[model samples]
Target: MTIRLRLAALCAAALVLTGCGAVITSPDQVTPEVYVEQPSVSPAAAKRFGDDKAEQAYQEVTKFALEQAFPEAFLDPAKKTYTAAELTAGVAPHLTPTAAQGWSSLVTLALAGDADAQDSLRILQFYNVDDPGSELPPDGDVLVRQQITDATVDVEEPSGDSPERLLVSFRHEAVLAYAEAGRPYELDVTKTMSYWLAPAGANAGSTWLIASYDGRMDVAVDS
Candidate 1:
């Protein structure tokens, strides 16, 4: 007998082959493989600047911010909740102190079941990964995974009123895949966001931190 399995993920404009197939004669012959796709950055934004140094910087910061702020879906079916500290720490490295504090409060309110907070953070969409009500399968691991399919990072130079400030924007398309009983289910998501960044300290070598942000995210799921 021959068995074939293929897992593909989109990274920017390139297609990434995440998992390969294996031929098995017996059911117990091989262990099942879990599909995972980490976020990826595109070079399209860097091309806008027309500078090699700027291109490198854009890719570096964009990837760093994505990993720090918007992480992939949770693959562990046993986990259900996130603490305020956990959520805050996940975003602290890329945000200013005040921004981090605000995010902490947001998570606190969401954890308490505040409807508005939940809506603002949009956590309930994929929170219950193991819910059977969604007609999830019972035999294999029920996991939720995400792939950053396409992404762009744009930078705006400081001018006029905000002479020293820099604006960085990230726009990305992602696919959220839910594997229920080992079957892949998918959803489409797109997010556009901008961050106002300033130096964390007065020193020239000080790192830039996100002071404020505005963004929108839309998810497309079956009706």
Candidate 2:
């Protein structure tokens, strides 16, 4: 994997494998993986700015994270039902077999209309808007911005010594979304998200995806 950066996201590109956990089978009986291509590192990279494998892994991971971070598919005002294929598109790629095992198990429950998944979706409502068109896509959806305050890449030891994880991180302000009044809604002016990525396998060509994430957005505001 290689490390590359973009305007916030557009990270993970294409990879050979799919599914972070288990194969997701929707009630509609359409396998999400069919519409998705194999996971690969994202393109239009930062241009030889960082380690190849780590940057590539970061691209792969952040792209998926930004996609899933959106509250759109899950919190549309129409209460639109996200097809398993669409809902699972950005997440499935770039997952390691080990991560996929646990991921699939949890996502399977979510796809099955599980309460937990529903609850997870509910949390994203704060980012939701009845009208997405209120703001331009670029302004509302700056996945990778020039605002990264800090970044670091760590390549794990091979030979199964240190779990062979590729960790990349970015410390940046949280990008918020637009709401009904046509104004940007930033809940926390001081909040920032710390992103982390890990490789899906031990080999040099092993793909990457977000294995862990930690951030905070606790601001006193009226939503």
The candidate that wins on TM-score is 1
User: Which ranges of candidate 2 are over 4 A from the true structure?
Assistant: 1-50, 66-68, 71-75, 111-147, 155-162, 172-174, 180-207, 210-223
Q: Per-residue alpha-carbon lDDT of model 1 for 1-223, expressed as tens digits?
A: 2112121111112211100122222334333222112223235434544345443444444554435433443434455777766655555566566555655565677689765554444421224334453443353333232223233444555567443434455554444454546666654555555555555665423256655555556666522
lDDT of 2 at 197: 50
- Candidate 1 scores a C-alpha RMSD against the true structure in Å of 12.3
TM-score per candidate, chains pooled? 0.54, 0.47
Steric collisions counted per model: 0, 27
**Global CA lDDT computed for model 2:** 0.39
Q: Write the per-residue lDDT of candidate 2 for residues 106-215, one digit (tens) a residue.
A: 44555576654433332211233334444433344422211233445554344543344444554433334334455544322222343345545555244655543334
Q: After superposition, how far is residue 44 of candidate 2 from its true place, in Å?
A: 26
What lDDT does candidate 1 reach at residue 37?
22
| Model 1 weakest 10-residue run by lDDT | 10-19
Predicted model with the maximum lDDT: 1
